[model samples]
Target chain A: MGDRAKSLRNTIVLIAGLLVFWQLMYAVIGEVAMRSPWQTMRYTVTLVETDFFWVHLTNTLQAFAVALVLSVVLGLLIGFALGLHRLSAEAMEPMLVALYSIPKITLYPIILLAFGLGMSAKIAFGAIHGIIPVALFTLNAVRSTKPILVKTGRVLKLSPPAMVRSILFPAAVPEIFTGLRVGFSLTLIGTVLGEMFAAQHGLGYLLMNAIGLYNVDVIMSVTFLLVVFAAGVNGILLAVDRRLHFRV
Target chain B: MRRVRLYQVGVIAGLLLLLEALCLAGVIDKITMPPPHRIAVDLVKLLLAGKLYPEIGKSLANVLLAFGLAYSTGIVTGTVLHGYRTARETLDPLFATYYAIPVFAFYPLFIVIFGLGDGPQVLIGFLLGVVAVIVTMLNGLDRVPRVLRKTASICRMGPFETAVHVTLPFCAPYLLTAAKLALAYAFIGVIGSEFIMARSGMGYEIGYAYTNFDNATMYPLIVLILLLSIVMNGVLTHWEKLLLARRGQR
Candidate 1:
């Protein structure tokens, strides 16, 4: 059989295996703390219908949207500025990477103090978390563009701005999209962590609030919602990436 | 490169000096940020008086242990996934998607199951870190050219022999890269769990200071965290450079 067909079959089998494992764990524990896969799935559907859940979900989404746009705009500008010059790019790359790798979540306390317990704190935290990776990736994307491509643009007597729009931007779009995916994920994590640490509303706040009440169902359901949402968004991003990442 | 290096150092020093000047002139709030000189002095005192050692030890121990666990499990899982081409294709999407999801929400669930303290802490750290290692290993192993498999058969080598002689050596550098990234994530995971709740750890100490609004202690702790991150990053860069130099020689 071809690899693709075999792989799809394997995926179905793996999903079945995961389900069995979840059920087995639930059986062994038989505790509310460890809900069955079926239970969490059912609870997830019910949670989606509630007004309270919607409010928190909206808050999380809003933070994500703001952070995503801010990070992308800032990342492109900074990345291009640095990436165009070899000296600046090499000197700054390490710092950018260090900042990106370390959990900026550690800086949350300072952010909370500065921005208060409002949505602003979450937005700032999420933006910072997302910005570094996007900027670093964009820098890399720009730096790695083919020299031949740029030479061809010059040969055609294209203006610098036109060169960027046609040659540089298109050549780097694939990597920029990779950065976007990473930024999206980090932004989600930042927003959730911010809400958990200090926020009146959001999925993270709800998760923590549920913990205080020892509401196991809510915790599992919330987690389920987060996973589904992340997977859905990632799938869309992946599709977009594949379409834009043309092989030259 | 040398000039750029000097420029970078100078820029960082200039920024620090500016911050020090502002704090010295009382331009910045003392409560929000103590002067750099004072923070340095206080940090030395905390280290000398043995106030922060136990917390550092606890956090370090958790990170190392969790990283060890992650390294082993991540390697095994990656190997298994890669061993079956179909499995590799199937699981790749799930793992990639999960790279973004907040695994922290499960901390409470872990607390309920493991009864808090170090068990849940280490487990959470392992979860956070293992993904990086697994993905690296899978990619590395996948990149081992198919020619090696053909060569192995020509030489009458068994599966074990082929893996050890061809596949393992080929991916050694990638494995090292994975180790570096895994350690970084392990520390982040360990510290994060500590921040949330821990009997003793750097993270727990930071959490304590923040809750009490103890700026005196918080600033120094943050400085310590920054130092730790810089040191880890330096080690990884040095190791990678050494590896590349050694490879160039061969």
Candidate 2:
């Protein structure tokens, strides 16, 4: 108990030290760059309070949300189809991996041309980038599903849907969750990239505008918000993962 | 199995051919989505002009330099953090916080600090690549077998000797894995930076073409970037395999 307490105290001290170091570095560099920590904080707060900030935030979030949903739905369907059959899995696995390895960013122009420069374009781009990981992960998860469980379900004379629900889905939950996390990260990247390429609104557009104007403070503030948002989303996923782990 | 593999390739090829056909048929508008032949011609022109090679060189240099900086810093920091568990616990969350932060979103800040040159691009690339390495190295260090450490200690190995012989070798596979992921992240970071603010890299070329509505030129640059990414990923994977084999001998 004493050792644990001592360790905890040491960890706290280390965190404090890091925070101090960060602040010191910011202070030293901030004056030269005109981007002090205090200034960034002030800007961040003021920006958040503005209605203009929320409009851009909402646009980006809406596109992101739609992309994520589409990717998840399409990914799982394709993954299941590939995973359920041995021949399909063997044939498609290499191609899937190759496609995943390709920088999907190159397809942005093609997507933009197909879908136009609206929200559809961004969503389609995001979906394309985000879906590959999900499919790959789901395929792996389903391939790893236990034969014993399948046999047991067969012995019970379960229906096809019942077998999937009780055996396959449950068994694949952990790996699917892993894929979902990766998919979420990729979705964020895709959405931002889409916005950067050609967009009239969103945080990506805002950041681009800030760059065009050379407004470092606004850029920094937007970046800070994105980081915080990503962290928050991650935290939520982690909490859910933990809860599911415990329940399972 | 072979037939299925062929089918998969055929499908992808078919998709590409369909797009080409559509452009040829004037259904998709050739100006907006040029046929594959036009893209190929543009690619040849870019290559013949000796413009493509220099852009590739510049992008490669930026990626490699930034990756090297990130790898060295990550390894050293990871080692130190791993040696002190309390320190690792404290720093881990902080690193995660930074990692979660979209490093690209700070392009403006980076441009302000390092100017609109290669310095800022490399800085952004390093920031994206380093965090993953640090996390992977730390995880690898934590999972190092206690028996190996005990054996080294029994041999009267000093701290530096033990780290050199035991810790680093034990962490080799993890470091390699991290390096692979870091390469991908670094590539994206550099390309994204160039896309947003660069004037010379392949990304800048793509951005320029898009703005000018030069679909033929843009397609070739996009293909070049994609090819670069694929070739780099293959090289790194092959290198990782070789290193893993060498480590297996021990």
Error of 1 at A62 (Å): 1.7
What does candidate 1's lDDT look like per residue over A100-131, in tens digits? 77757678788877777788999998889888
Off by over 4 Å in 1: A1-14, B21-27, B146-162
**How much is the TM-score of the A chain of model 1?**
0.93
DockQ of the candidate models in sequence: 0.59, 0.45
Off by over 4 Å in 2: A1-22, A31-34, A90-102, A246-248, B1-14, B25-27, B95-99, B151-167, B239-250
What are the per-residue Cα lDDT tens digits for candidate 2 across B1-250?
Answer: 5788687888879988998899899998866778877888888898888857888789878988888888888888887777787667656545644544566777777777778899988888888888888899989988889999999999999989998999888888788777876777777778778887788887787777787888867888887777777777767767777877786742
Candidate 2 residue pairs that clash: none
The model with the greatest DockQ is 1
Which residue pairs in candidate 1 collide?
none
What is the C-alpha local distance difference test score of candidate 2? Answer: 0.79
The CAPRI category of model 2 is acceptable
- Candidate 2 lDDT over A46-123, as tens digits, reads 999999999999999999999999889998888877887877787777567667766576677778778889799999
